[model samples]
Target: MDYIDSICNASASILDMTPAVRKPEEGKVVLDYILDNCAKWPNKIFLTQPMGGDEVLNVTFSEFLSESKKMAAYIESLNLPAPSQIAIMSKNCVWWLMADLAIMMSGHCAVPIYPTLTAETVKYTLEHSESKLLFVGKLDTHPWNEMKKGIPAGMSCVSFPICPSDVSYDKWADLIGDNEEIKEIKKRTPEEMATIIYTSGSTGVPKGVMLSFKNLTDTTFGLINTTHATENDRYLSYLPISHGMERWVGECLPFITGLHVFYAESLTTFVQDLNRCQPTLFLSVPRLWTKFQLGVFKKMPPEKLQKLLKIPFISYLVKKKLLKALGLNHVRYAGSGSAPLPPDLLAWYRSLGLELLEGYGMTENFNYSHMSKPGGGRVGYVGEPSEGVEQRIAADGEIQVKSPGMMMGYFKNEEATKETMTEDGWLRTGDKGELDDAGRLKITGRTKEIFKTSKGKYVAPAPIENQYISNIRIELACVGGRGHQAANAILMLSEDAKKEAAESGGKDAIEKELEELIKTVNSGLDDHEKLQFVAVVNDVWEPENGFLTPTNKIKRARIEEEYNPLMEEWYNSKKKVIWHKW
Candidate 1:
């Protein structure tokens, strides 16, 4: 009658890794095994990404270990106390994880910070957590500069690869100063803190969730069992490494499964990088995947593409091949998380021969909760409580969980931590959802984001936003109906579609097209749930503005505040982009 039993014994024909049932008792606790094994498989093309033309930065297993050790030695020389916080900020790349491993190896806790965080949020987090050290990749500047202004005096700092900056950096060769027989200090307990991951900052000021080595290790095993990830698989670490989803899959699981990981340079070029890498398993948040899907549609004008695909023969053959060729071909295992993935998007991705799986987890859970089971076609449900994970639906329908991956507690916030979990110890996931007939988890919506209109209709902004975006334009949409007369959407235009519209028509025409697009998107929703108004964002939301979180989800609260006053005019008027002159 329990959740796991219900899932394992459910009515579905899913792939079972039964004969090779993974036993945690048999898994290694140390991170050394993964690093060492990759060295042994040195010639197997561990990690790679292409540059402008024929130029690629490739790392062999042996090179990875050497660089990590050098960075680790540099980490030791900092002489910070054990459990000192080492924060990482940047886009996903090989060095990002390298610094993360170095922090762990040197006995410091890694705190992942978003590159897109606003100056104010960065100030609050750095000072609140009292993190002494930070490693920023060369990609982002504002967060680093803003964070620099906020830190207290004498806080030690480091940067990836050694850029010339005020903060000290690892010189690689000069880092040998720690030697004269450097002793490797190992924390024997799995409960020893490994990282303090702050919340995605979607709703409010981020809460620092302190996770231990056992939490990371156990979650890695749980993910391995659920996804059947192996040493031979390749992963593209294009997602922001700051988010929990990225930390678990892009960082922890690689240690557990020994998968090779390559980083894409920037968000603008992620798809191109994805094609160059041909990753075996790619993990990303829903926003990016939906953008990729939109890009595919834009390449062939949607009406033309949609009609051609409607023909059974072409749909069966040509359309499938086109999607696969666009770097999506080898993504055997694709996982979506950070924010809930729209079920409609999942079904559409599948239509292109892509296996889209939804994963549920938060920083508080060390990013392990429920993952759709392999071979199980549970479209809307986050499959089952992953191996070694326990899930329960609380009285109010919030999904609560107990797992080895649970954090030690919120950093220096005992009262807040206590409030998050039950007295008996289950971490409460703030989002609300229900358990289906098959015992699978279906996330209905966020409890807080739901708004009730004067007419007595309760509308959850997420589901409404998903309906607008799952198969439509707008990179990300946030709904705000509470306290307002009606609901509206703040949208970021699709990059590819924007470009196509520009080439075919002028900017004014492109803007006009978006208005029509909004009409079509709105037609699918109800009078109450449908957006009462829409705003087309000319510029995309970036991390610098704090309008977007690191995982690329919109910072809804910030957007609402910025646009709060305009609602009157927009709601009173009719078309999209109320601020921009039509």
Candidate 2:
């Protein structure tokens, strides 16, 4: 049978159950929800932003509505074209949300640019979207200085209170000072465009994903239903809000659920902010999660902690203290996404009584695809399809999905849009995956990332890389084996690991540990998939250096271009672990 026929037969039993749909009121756009909340809870605190140490700015529902209205009025007074595209380039802060609401209120589409993006990318996004205005807020001074050069000299710009003092743009307070609230709030239809979110661009140049009101509402409402979100829940917003995952979970969900959102002040104060908020719902990427685990290990050595956990009474106290220290004590729903989470990490958190869920999605679908449910999770699986989402596997093992939250198309890129969708209207997720009998999905590898070895065997890098990254000493791992005798990996050591390596006899100890780790990892792999060597690189990989994306995803093309030439030399050396510095 053909791929479609096979998919239909395979999913027939799994799809027999009725899928979850959005609530009646959930069909309304985000603006409508904000208005309803203003009427229902005018005095309720909705957003909290940290100004600095021990000082925070809070905005209530009524205050939020008032400020959004005044900003909307100011925007309308400018008399740009109706439904003009406006861009907000800022970090996650209270003004980012206010500016977004104002843009929607003024009958304009919003475009969000990652705060960590380079000047070239920022320029490309603004020019591609044809944005007429820009709002600048909360950014690192150095990146802001760099990104400011990309703004067209003729384009009008507005600055939030937290913006750099040196900027020569019209201040937000000044623009709204004299303008009256708009007489009528412009309401948008479900089909109307809400935002154009650019992808994080791990493989190539970023593409703008055009999302509508319906797309946002469906994903937000679906999450609310699944998580049982309420106004009492608190969320800490630390992830970049420009990405689809954070925008949907941290920003849009609050509009519908009235959840209290606390903005993290800075990296140095992240744990402090988390402790203050004690959020009830938390979302993070695997890298941060690994860091948290390392922090815990630093405080209490793993061997000692394991011994203490053997005692029943001490185990409870240890778990509670650990969660409290991480500011996840009150977290009822914790999610990890954007990259594959190691199963070991999931088990570790679960042992501490945190039900850490693994979710799978893409920007093209507004990040509504699959999410593990409470008490129904299996290790190494991304769980069943999310509410109102339908998924199937193609003949080539690629996973295809259709969801109510799917994007309209790429902005001004019809050819790329066509390449991303199937003839039957499903989004072609480049991920290769399989469905369990219960319809849970497990990703195998990316179609574009698989490479061939000299032995004519195919190698999937992600799974092998996951094995290496599970070691606390390793920070990032990349595997490549195109025309090579065997697959090999490049690893960057964690900060603490690097410090340890600098000490007397430390380098030898680490080399021994890494050799053991390699042996352990190879035991689980097939003959061709086993890594031939582990090369420790001396360089750092970050977004500023063009080695990683703004979302912490590695830039595969750039990394390969820089390192592939040395593969033959490293292989011929016949060393199991080679430190680049040595």
Candidate 3:
């Protein structure tokens, strides 16, 4: 029997489940699209970057192109070698995109570093990639202070106008003003390298994935086709541009469609920025989606909101008011990715009239993979294989994919690249999944993340962890107990849930609710997979604390290392729920 047949409905043929790898159509590259947009809509607003309250600077397409060309000329004047690597370290902003365009125009590849990385990791990436120059832009004080130490002294540096005032560098405005705009655009072949994206892994050193111009163009066209993207669409760019999804959807897609892009000022002003943009398409990770829901619950209690939603006329108005306040009333398409969203949460958003969909992808493929169809999505599955994407499950149950936008290789790491790719050219996804009757893909867990208990039965933690977080009281969870009789879950409470615990009788109510939740969750699991107890940890796991990645995915290895030693003690407590301190 075939792998697809093993999991999918008997009537669904294997050929229907796996499509042939599609070749990219010969066409103009992303740079060509930008040039075309400039010629077509020279005076149209291209980027809206916020400053302080009620103040935003909007740049027209002509202005953007002219400034980028000037920056390119300035870069050329430095006499750097062709195909040099230029690094940009900043939060999402307009100048960040401009620096990227300048790098492209200057006939170089860009290396974007996450703004939240530690000094040591930052130094490692820059040194490993051998970046020739660095562009520093919009960042907070503490992060800049920490990240600056990683920059190699005497390295050529340029500063965007909105950068921290503590350090002096050649200013973007002054440099572009001093230089002449290059009259000719740099011509690039489709096969030429475009960028080196370093994966911010949950464990170990980050690997730089090399992608070509054709790879990006192929992925962009696939995205445009599936999403029905148009020039009238609006996008709010808040995620790190260094990430693959943001780079593809937020940065690359806009060039092709001339869509207006808005930059979020800061976390403090995200809601205000969202209101200003009122984006048509929105994408976020599960953590943020949960936070958004919790934000709503903070205003009106969930019980009251549910009761109000049951009324006919009042339900319509309540939904409208809530969605409008969240700045999602205009969102025609919404998506969740990077991690699994609890099904109830997904249902919650859909119930409110937002078309929230789930997607699946990784950095290696430029995130051009599966996405739920507008109205064809299942609760727990990411939609079927995208056009030109081929997927197959190996005998070991790992999902391997071949896509048009697959990376060329890892930068300066042939061994790792070779290990990741199969001889037939498919990229190993490292994820275990199953195909359903409707061809949706349900990711079970990471193959490497599965742990065997003392009874010798392997346990996949993802589904169980999902069960824990589905109860709104828990914000994040990790399930483990590799050598124990049964697994255990460590939980972090949501801010509001914690606040509730501080009030009279609130802690007892939460405790009772959690005890019931664990019982209900355990009833559905295999005996060996059932959790012995759940510990409510006193501290929250965050990126700064080294417990989570910058993207909010837990660093499992770190979590296990910190907690596995005390597993016996936790098990000895003999309580269904335990309050733990580390």
Candidate 4:
């Protein structure tokens, strides 16, 4: 069977599971939930952030409300016009959420910028959003000297307590009064602007996506109902809160559900934080999941683990022990999104007793489009449309969606906004997808990323690339061949793989293993889709290197552009794979 047919067959069993239709809470906003929770669960731990050496800072529901009110009062004191724009550039932290809540409380729109963004983009976002005030917090990787130049001259700025920058700014502590009492909360209507989140464009300039209070609240409620999450659940906030997925789920979801959230201090403390939080709900991207698998293999080789899993009683104990060691034994709902996950990887996780639910959504939709249900083992598909979400595949294979959570539009870009949505009002997702026989959506590739080969046959790279990276050794694999006879790939070895290669036969051993991996992957593809040659690059893709988005998604177009010059020479080489010497 072909690709579409195979997906349908795989999803046949779960097709009968209908999605739950939950009505959004229209009368209440996210802020209302926070205020109500404060009254109901005043002493409950609302947010947690780790410091060094077994020390952690916990904020109770009451304290969160009080602090946010004080911050809002300070913001109101600024005397900025109603609905003024305020920009926040920070990593995920308690202050980020407090500032966001404060912005809404003061009747202003919050604009979030990824903390890792460059000075040029930062300046462009600040100017384009027309933000009157800025909250600078936890800018670890940002070039402060160069970035401060981008801040509009004399623009009022407040520095978080933990901010390491020497840039001149008013301290958040001095701005707030001793008394937490503030003016009565300003009630915002459902249609009132809440935030303008700029897209972390993997290609080209980032555009501000305008979202209303209604959009975010509706999406949060939908997710809570669909996932069956409750106040007892715990969440870890580590992903960049500037990204829409983290903003909605990691930040907004906690307010609605009253779930306790723990913040990772840094990458070094990620494991310790996870163990301390023991989060009931966890969301991670595909790359991290692969890393987790690699971590497991490091302790016990994959071959050994597979053989051990085949044993009857020992397999159960092994799986339990392995999960606990990874600090995921308590994770009831594990989700993967922001990129497509390979089917093999999903199955591998399932065997270890962690059902990695694949979700499908984008920044434009408040990251609430489709998600796999618990106990529903639909491996390759992203499950059915979410509650109150309508989806259809366009004639050209793009997935179109209409939902209450959909963004208002691209902020201040009318022409681009018009082009993004259909005349009939469906938002164009720009992703090529197909609905399986079970009505589950399976994303095939990106519309703009598909390339036509010299043989006049079009090839979608994502699916092939996903297959290629299924091997744990292959960290990143970018597939492309716009005018070539066959598709080619640029492969980067995983960190562990690189170390293993260096220890064991060096480049020759790495090349041999990669050649075998390519042969194995190509055997599963059709002639036109098979990778003719792969250039093994030593450099790893990273956000700082302009190869990955802040959310850790590969920048496909950027990778292709960077490696275009080396492609022809690699393709002309006699060997099936060429090791690129960078």
Q: Which structure among the candidates has the greatest lDDT? A: 2
The segments of candidate 2 whose C-alpha lies over 4 angstroms from its true place after superposition are 1-22
Residue 145 displacement (Å), model 4: 5.9
Q: Which pairs of residues clash in candidate 1, taking residues 3 or more apart in a chain or in different chains?
A: 116-543
Q: Write model 4 residue lDDT over 328-360, tens digit each, in one string.
A: 888777877677788889889888877777778
TM-score of 2: 0.95
Model 1 agreement with the true structure over 1-582: per-residue lDDT tens digits: 001101121112335334365655443454655555665676665567554455677877666666666677767776788768777766666667677767767777788777666667767777777787777565555466665565455655555552325555544345543443224735435768877888867777788988877787777777676656788777877666677767777777776667777777666766677777787777666777777777676577667766877789988785557756577666556767666667778776666656676767777877677777656648767776777788888888887889777889999899889889998889888778888777788888877777886667878787677765764646777777666666777776666655654574556665676577668867887777766667766666766677877666677788888878777777778665553332
**Model 2 poorest 10 in a row by lDDT:** 1-10
Q: Find the candidate with the highest TM-score and give its number.
A: 2
Arranged by lDDT with the best first, the candidates are 2, 3, 4, 1
- TM of each candidate vs. truth: 0.86, 0.95, 0.94, 0.94
lDDT of 2 by residue, 54-90 (tens): 8899999998888888999989989989899999999
lDDT of 3 by residue, 406-467 (tens): 99999999999998899999999888999998888989988888999999999999999998
Pick the winner on lDDT between candidates 2 and 4. Answer: 2
Taken over the whole model, the C-alpha lDDT of each candidate is: 0.68, 0.86, 0.84, 0.82
The TM-score measured for candidate 4 stands at: 0.94
Higher-lDDT candidate of 2 and 3: 2
- Segments of candidate 1 deviating more than 4 angstroms: 1-19, 30-32, 35-45, 49-54, 141-148, 151-153, 162-173, 176-181, 185-187, 306-320, 455-457, 496-530, 537-539, 574-582
